[model samples]
Target: MSSIDIQHPHTLAPAKARKAVEEVAKKLAERFDVEYGWVGDTLNFSRSGVDGKIALQPNQLHVSAQLGFLLGALKGPIESEIRRVLEERFK
Candidate 1:
């Protein structure tokens, strides 16, 4: 398995940050078939070959994921896309 762990800082308030996360999650659901829900301030998600969580804080978002064997090989692009999305949404 391959793992991705990113800590992204943001200036948004908690409520706004949560809303941004929800928007990201909705796009992920539609584009990647990911299923997710929030538990406290953390948003947990999973799909066929991936499992992850995005933990929201007042000024930061911690994204962590574990990729299965096949997808692990494509980790670079996947991580890049995630970073792109986070950058676009949070900045």
Candidate 2:
């Protein structure tokens, strides 16, 4: 298994950040068939070959995920896409 951990800083208010995260999650669910939900300020998500959580902090978002064997091989591209998404949405 491969793991990904990223801390992204943002300036949006908590409520707005949460909404942005929800939008991201919805898109992930639609595109990747993932299932996700919120637990306080954290959003937990999973699918057949992955599991992860995004924890929202006052000034940062912590994203962590574990990829299964097949997906692990594609980690670099996946991580890059995630970073791109964060930059696009949180900026």
Candidate 3:
């Protein structure tokens, strides 16, 4: 499986960071059927052929996803979108 791991450092409060991650999760779920929730401070998400987590820290938001064979082919666009969304929301 190909992996998409992105770490974005931020100075936002934990609550705000969580909210941002939640918004991304919601949008992802709409199109990808992603299932997600908080496991302690980490937002874990998964679906067939994909799995990842958004680890919320005081000054950093780490996002990671693993794509299976079929989906791996689209890794570039997928990663790009994730980057775009993170930049948009976490700004």
Highest TM-score, which number? 2
What residue runs in model 3 are displaced by over 4 Å at the alpha carbon?
none
Question: What is residue 67's positional error in candidate 3, in angstroms?
Answer: 0.7
Lowest lDDT 10-residue stretch of candidate 3:
82-91
Give the top-scoring candidate (lDDT): 2
Model 1 RMSD in angstroms:
0.7
**Residue 54 error, candidate 2, Å:** 0.4
lDDT of 3: 0.88
Q: Rank the candidates by TM-score, best first.
A: 2, 1, 3
The RMSD of every model to the true structure, in order and in angstroms, is 0.7, 0.4, 1.0
Which should have the higher lDDT, number 2 or number 3? 2
List model 1 lDDT by residue over 1-91, tens digit each.
Answer: 9999999999988999999999999999999899999999999999999999999976889999999999999999999999998898887
Colliding residue pairs in candidate 2: none
Per-prediction TM-score, please? 0.96, 0.98, 0.93
Candidate 3: tens digits of C-alpha lDDT, residues 1-91:
8998898878788888888788878988998798998899999999999988989977988888889998899999999988888788787
lDDT of 2 by residue, 34-89 (tens): 99999999999999999999999998999999999999999999999999999999
